[model samples]
Target chain A: MTQVIISPAKANSMYWLGRYTERVYLELHLLRICFDFMIDGKPEEYNRYLASIGNTFLYPDLAAIRSGLVHDKNNPVSVLACVEMANDNAILLRDEIMSPTLGYIQMSLEYLRHAAAESKEPDLDELQKLTDWMLAFWGSIEERVYDERVKNFLRLGKLIEHLDMNIRFSYKFYRIEEAFTSLLKCYDFEPRAFSGDALEDLKKLITEQEYDPRDPVYVNKVLLLLGKVVIL
Target chain B: MQSLIKNRDSVNRWMERYGVRFGVYKNGVFNEQLFPFDSIPRIIEKEDWKVLEKGLIQRVKALNAFLWDIYHDKHIIADGVVPEEFVYASKGYMPECEKVDPTGKVYSHISGIDLVEGKDGRWFILEDNLRIPSGASYPMIAREITRKVSPITFVENHVADNRDYATILKEMMDDMNGGRGINVILTPGRYNSAFFEHSYLAEKTGAVLAFPGDMTVEDDIVWYTGLFNEKIRVGAIYRRISDEYLDPLAFESSSLLGVPNLFQAYKKGTVAVINGFGNGVADDKGIYYFVPKMIRYYLDEEPILHNAPTYLPYFKEDYDYILENISRLVIKDVSEAGGYGVVFGRDLSLEKLSELKELIIHQPRRWIAQEVIDFKDLEILESNEKVERKADLRAFVVSSGKDVKVWKSGLTRFSRNPDSFVVNSSQGGGFKDTWIMD
Candidate 1:
């Protein structure tokens, strides 16, 4: 019956661990889907897709674009960069996470680092393994994290990132609604002003059949609301 | 042993997974590096550990009694067993902690005593670390990962388990909890060099890993504040911060690391502070010279362990001896730790030796010279080849109430540089898990 108080610093790290892990996972998946464009040698489409996700960098070839997506440490959006940040955060919360769980993060990072060092031709098969490890990472979180409150905070950060990614990628309104529904089902957040009320407003818009999903202002407001957390 | 040698990198990888790292700050930037692990372990026969356990327990007990006397009755100093100047002038001596009764009346609840074995099979006490000593987790977790890397080696060898450190630590903390509340491990933050240890021990002990701001002091009581504003009273604090930064109101005015009025709470007798404040007096290099005298004066017994032949320049005879043997002794600055401020006579040029001799003559109290023991060299692997390295053991002994226990394992640190004798982790040394054979 020893006391277990998570310092604010650790809680904040766990929150970001959730955010960065989800961010990298989503970005990696999106790029895997975009690999078809890379294969077709439509570098322009990849450029357009990168711009759509707020990446303004210009690349002449698919290799440069692929490098920016997967390996570039300087590029903040790369899988390697996001995983490194997530791994850093996870390192601080080693007690909160499982040993095998953290091992996955470290091994995945080392594998990516090694791949980057070799600078070989892009191996999509290996890149897909990164995605698989992300799944295992979340699975480990669900299995190993003991404190429900701690887990809830992590899940909340992840849900917020999920909502943000869906919005930025312009997923269909139904898909956004489904993700929002899941967020409401699993997420937990600290109670604050505008969070509860704004959440309800977004729910109202999402559930309403008459609302137009094309309205930018309405979509922005809904995005803001879906960022709020609540257990279903 | 063969399997362990082959699986060294795998164990190191597991250490990285567990974030076995130490942080260092240089040029105002913080950098963290792993405390490299050597697959080879330092092995001690059970008979040797038996002697070590007895000596360590006896030494810690004498040191604890010394702290109590230094603060309360001053019998040791008044009777002239130790000079009052030596005890009062130490940097770690806190005047605010005078006469404060610690939990179970224990001052040094935990002690990490550095020891080395000589070539002639005799052990020498290098130094005593009474204030917030670390490096225990290195050997503890190293044993855990080592077991993974070479299970067959462990299955075959009769090594005593070191994994029980957490349970023993928790029991000590429980005993230290003289009041009604929860135990907390208060750390400065994640930026500390031993932050990994702070968190790891907290997790294992089920103690709260808390920062300065997570808790508040009110009515001379420490409270752990939750996000929902619920407060839990703290019974005992295994505080890892230095005494100067333990309480802003009581020690340093500008320290943000300290909790405001925490010393007030401790003074009010609501919380137990481990290794009690002002204990630096007992571990001071100057005071170290008097430990044998203390063992006799307090315990009325002969010391079971031996200190390396040491000469205090503060005494005229010892000073004369140090001057005569300026080319054959190792001189240490009383103020420095972590392998800093150590000078070997042979390493110094004649000019430097003369300069050091002059400084010692002027400020005799600041220097202590010792005839370096020809310590045994342990074999360590470097680049897949076995090489002999100078290494020393740091043994952690925990005491609470009447119970005292020496942990079965120790951290054996070896100097990575071929020419260096200092084996501090801060000095780029590496460590191996110490196995006290069952």
Candidate 2:
């Protein structure tokens, strides 16, 4: 088989497509959990979710919070916005990724727009479909994309985003460790893209015995280290 | 066929799921809209296709010969078969490519010849698009989805398979490459009007889809730039960009969408540019008037295809005739394309007709008047109702180093409006697959 060569722009687009799709998927999952908590009489759950994602703006009510997080076009962290960004990047990689693979992103964008237009409050079922489409999108990517290097770049973006989101949500140490391990496997495909010193520092921080999820300074340090791992 | 028509909705939905769309700019904002597919196919009988196939191959071969002569020996001009003024004064005539020769002397490797069938069972050539002709992918993908939606329709009808277009394209590119390096389809980015076709064709042909800055030239050789500064030599490029925006250092200095010195690589014979440079001169509307003469001069044979009755105002007799019969003719400005700069004399008021007459008299070489043939209309599905609409067929011809071959199927575009004859995608028209009977 002939070697598949990817240009810089295509590689960048593929990486970002992976990252943004993961962002949309994980954000909706977290939002659904927080929404359940709010429904169970914990009104402060929305504020806690916002703080976890590092978003500063607060919604006026539960309805406002759901709309802002799911359908707000102006909100950079909104599910709709992330879907659009993933689509924008996927559009540029259609030749490499194939149309059927790109179709999932297009479907998700169309579904989000249609659902938002139909209701003021975010429909949980429709949001569930968006998450399903993201899963299908990744599935299509795995089945359709042929180049191993292209898959590696996209997988790297996905693993890194998963690690970042798990760290932000203060997940269990095992989950963070699993995400980082998955990322390290993909990072081995293109180690030149990662900073060696930062990789070493992140390895040390994650392997530490007292790696507490509730410690703010330690979490900040891990996040900082994670940010420095990828050198664009 | 009935089953296909009944499942038009499913076919269109499949088209949407695959993101089959074309980009258009309205009021300075770019929007990507789905190229609506009508399930009702335009069926061509095998006997009719046989004649069309012969005519198209003959025409493309003659056109290639004309380009070679015009750029090198100028024998057609020397013999006065084609007017010197029409050849030299054409906007597509480039002095920079006067002596440059492309691989295998194949200038128009791919030709999209637009034709409209008349009510009298005659096909009249409307235009020849030798430079970056689109709409092939629309029909190619439409057939894919339509067959999926209604396999029984394909089974019942003995229609020729239209799926070999990508293979034909690949073979042509390989013929031009001559085992140099990898093949790439260079696109002007995703915002271009035909970006979907660009990407789709790249995927189908197994060619790399390259954007503007994805390539660079060094020492008269073109190379694709990888993320880590790795360079892979490009053997052939099926460039979708216009000649003006192909190379910044050679043609348009201000073009950011062109690779600098890429033209130098082409001129040095280090790279093969499909549908080679300086091909616009042959496809100009004014130059279209002499294509029949070109067939005779170059091929030593009578044209199997017929040109629409066209009169160039550059000649005294034709000029007087156009002025005398202004209301019955359609005047076209040779410089504009995509259904623009076309004026029906019947639609213009008396004042506008007078102004057009003056413009034609002052700049006779810039215009051509054709007797509008009442082309046969094809039936299209509109809101669950079958309606008659004006449609034209765009047959694609591929010229490799070996021979010229015409694809069995064509892109049949129809005007959605009842009163309109323009069938371009940019003008909000829809498309139907052309099924050539086996």
Using TM-score, give the best candidate's number.
2
| DockQ value of candidate 2 | 0.63
TM-score of 2: 0.97
**Model 1, residue pairs in steric clash:** none
* Residue B437, candidate 2: alpha-carbon lDDT: 98
DockQ of each: 0.41, 0.63
Cα lDDT of model 2 by residue, A94-201, tens digit = 778888888899888877777677756887875788888889998987788778888887887788788888888888888888888888887778887788999998
Task: List the pairs of residues colliding in candidate 2.
Answer: none
What are the candidates' C-alpha RMSDs?
2.5, 1.6
Off by over 4 Å in 1: A1-8, A58-60, A113-122, A186-194, A205-232
lDDT of 2 by residue, B288-365 (tens): 999999999999999999999999999899999999999999999999999999999999999999999999989999
Docking quality tier of candidate 2? medium
